[model samples]
Target chain A: MALKPLGDRIVIKQVEKEETTKSGIVLPGTAQEKPQIAEVIAVGPGGIVDGKEVKMEVKPGDRVIYSKYAGTEVKYDGEEYIIIKQSDVLAVIE
Target chain B: MALKPLGDRIVIKQVEKEETTKSGIVLPGTAQEKPQIAEVIAVGPGGIVDGKEVKMEVKPGDRVIYSKYAGTEVKYDGEEYIIIKQSDVLAVIE
Candidate 1:
C-alpha cells in the first residue's frame, strides 16, 4: 500500500546515517545522535485551516530536516515510512 | 528579550496542563502526559530553501500541536518559551 499524508501532513523517509565521517574514522553509534534528515515522498495539498490558507512548501524529492521524535512511523510495502504534518518539517536540504 | 524564530522556525509557549479532568477531580501530574499543545508567539520569515518558498502557516495567538521532544526551551522576560522550526508544529487549533 502507498502512503499519503492528509491535511497539512507530509510523508518522509529517514535518511541513513553513515557510520564514519569524511576522515574515514569510525564512530560509535552511541556517540552519535540519531539524524533527523529525511526525503519527501508525498505532500498533502494545502487547504483552508482555521479560516486561513495553508500552503505546502516542500515537494517530492526534497530532502528535509525535522524533529527527532516527530511523526508516526509505519511500515508499508515492506518499507518503513513516517507521516508528519508539513509544520513538522524544519528545513529543506539542498 | 523578544524571541523570534529564524528561517522556518517559530516560537511557542507550551500550554499548562490541568491537574484535573473535565469531571473536576484532581489527578497527579505524573498521571498526565505532557501537553503537546502550544501558543504561537513569533514566526520566522520564510525565504528560499532548496529552491522552494516556505510559508508561515500559524500566526501569533494561534494554538498549535507539536512533537513533545521538539524545540529548545529558554527563559526570556521572566517567561519560558520554546523555539522550534515551523515543521515542528503539527497542527493549528481552530
Candidate 2:
C-alpha cells in the first residue's frame, strides 16, 4: 500500500537497526535503540507560504539520515512509518 | 548576541524542560528526557531551489514545537541553539 503525505510532509520507511555492534556482537531487537536511517517513500508537494507554493528538494527513493528521536511514528499496512516535515530531514545520502 | 541562519535554516532556543510533572512531581535534570519545545530566534532566507528562493513561513519570536531530536545543537554566548529546517517544525503557536 502506498501512502501520500499532505503538504510538505514526508513519509519514511525506517531502515532496520543494525543488528550487530561494531565488535560483531549481535543485539536482539528488544535491545536495540531507535533507528536513525530511513528510505524516503513518499513526499508531499511544497508547503504554502504567503500564497506562494514551495517545492521540496528531496524526492522519493532517496536515502536519508534523520535524528534518532525525530518524527511521529505511525503504523500503516503493518509497517512502521515516520511522518516528518521536509526540514526534519537532516541530509540526503549521497 | 544574535545569530543569522543561512538559506532555509532556523535557529531555535530551547524552552527549558518541564521541571515538574503534571501531577506535581518534580523530576531531576538527569531524569529529564530531551526537550521538544523551542522558540524561534532566527530564520534563514529561504532555500534556493531551481535557482528560485523559497521564503520561510516562520519568523523570529514564534513559539514552535519540533521533534525532540531534530536538530544540530550548537552553543554560542553560553546559550544553546538548535538549527533545523523549516520542515522540521511541527507547529507554530498563535
Q: Which candidate is the best by lDDT?
A: 2
Tens digit of per-residue lDDT, candidate 1, span A2-48? 44454578778876656224324332323233336778888877774
lDDT by residue (tens digit), candidate 1, B1-94:
3776787788888766562133132211111223355678888886754455677767889866565455689898889999887666644544
Interface DockQ per candidate: 0.03, 0.03
Give candidate 2 regions above 4 Å deviation: A1-94, B19-35, B47-52, B68-70
What does candidate 2's lDDT look like per residue over B36-79, in tens digits?
55689998888674465566878799866455545798999989
Query: Can you list the residue pairs that collide in candidate 1?
Result: A87-B87, A88-B87, A89-B87
Candidate 2 residue A42 C-alpha distance from true site, Å: 21
TM-score of model 1 (CA atoms): 0.46
lDDT of 2 at B73: 89
